[model samples]
Target: MIRQRVIVHGRVQAVGFRFSARVEAQRLGVSGWIRNRNDGAVEAEIEGEAASVDAMLAWLDEGPPGAEVTSLSTADLAPTGERGFRVLS
Candidate 1:
């Protein structure tokens, strides 16, 4: 399993990014949580098989239709065996 902490910038807030990410993560069998950062960025931690995680990261670049993802930053993390994906307040 692989895990990553991703920070997505630009037009991410108030654009349904979190919900869309949760849906995609679930579909990819990824586990983690996503939330809006105070810096106007969307932050998430995803854990799953390498292929699934990679797919998730790629999807984050596109995000929801209304979302305009300008850039993405990711960091490798140790898996915590997390289950399910969620949107955090």
Candidate 2:
């Protein structure tokens, strides 16, 4: 298993980015949570098979059609042992 924390920048907020991420993560069989940041970025922590996690990160780069992803920064992290994917408030 692999775990990562990612911060995505650009036209992410209020663009259904978090919700889209939740769906994508769930579809990929990943467990994590996504949320909006005050700095206008989207933040998420994903845990799953390495390939699935990597695929989700790649999808995050493009995001929803309305999103203009300018940057994505990810860091290796220990798994949180969470179940299911969700959107955080």
Candidate 3:
């Protein structure tokens, strides 16, 4: 398993991005946390199997219905061994 930190840009906040991420991550059996950044973006840390991690990254591209995901930037990170996905306030 591996971890990735993704920063979603453009029309992400207040548009259900974090909520959708929570659901998607759980469904994919991923463990991580998602929250809004002060710079008007949504940041997330996801860890799981390789295939599942790829799936999550792809989902972040489109995001939720109301979200206008302009783009997403990701970086590799050491696995945190997180247990569940959460929407951090």
Give the winner by TM-score. 1
lDDT of 1 at 50: 99
Per-model TM-score on C-alpha atoms: 0.98, 0.96, 0.97
Tens-digit per-residue lDDT, 1-89, candidate 3: 99999999999998888998899998999999999999999999999999999999999999999999998999999998889998999
Lowest lDDT block of 10, candidate 3: 13-22
Models ranked on TM-score: 1, 3, 2
**lDDT by residue for model 2 (19-81), tens:** 888889989999989989899999999999999999999999999979999999999999878
RMSD (Å) of each candidate, 1 decimal: 0.5, 0.7, 0.6
Which has the higher TM-score value, candidate number 1 or candidate number 3? 1
Superposed model 2: Cα runs more than 4 Å off: none
Name the lDDT of candidate 3: 0.94
Candidate 3 pairs with clashing backbones = none
What is the total number of backbone clashes in candidate 1?
0
- Which 10 consecutive positions of candidate 1 have the poorest summed lDDT? 14-23
Write candidate 1's Cα lDDT for 1-89 as tens digits.
99999999999999889998999999999999999999999999999999999999999999999999999999999999999999999
Residue 18 shift from truth in candidate 2, angstroms? 0.7
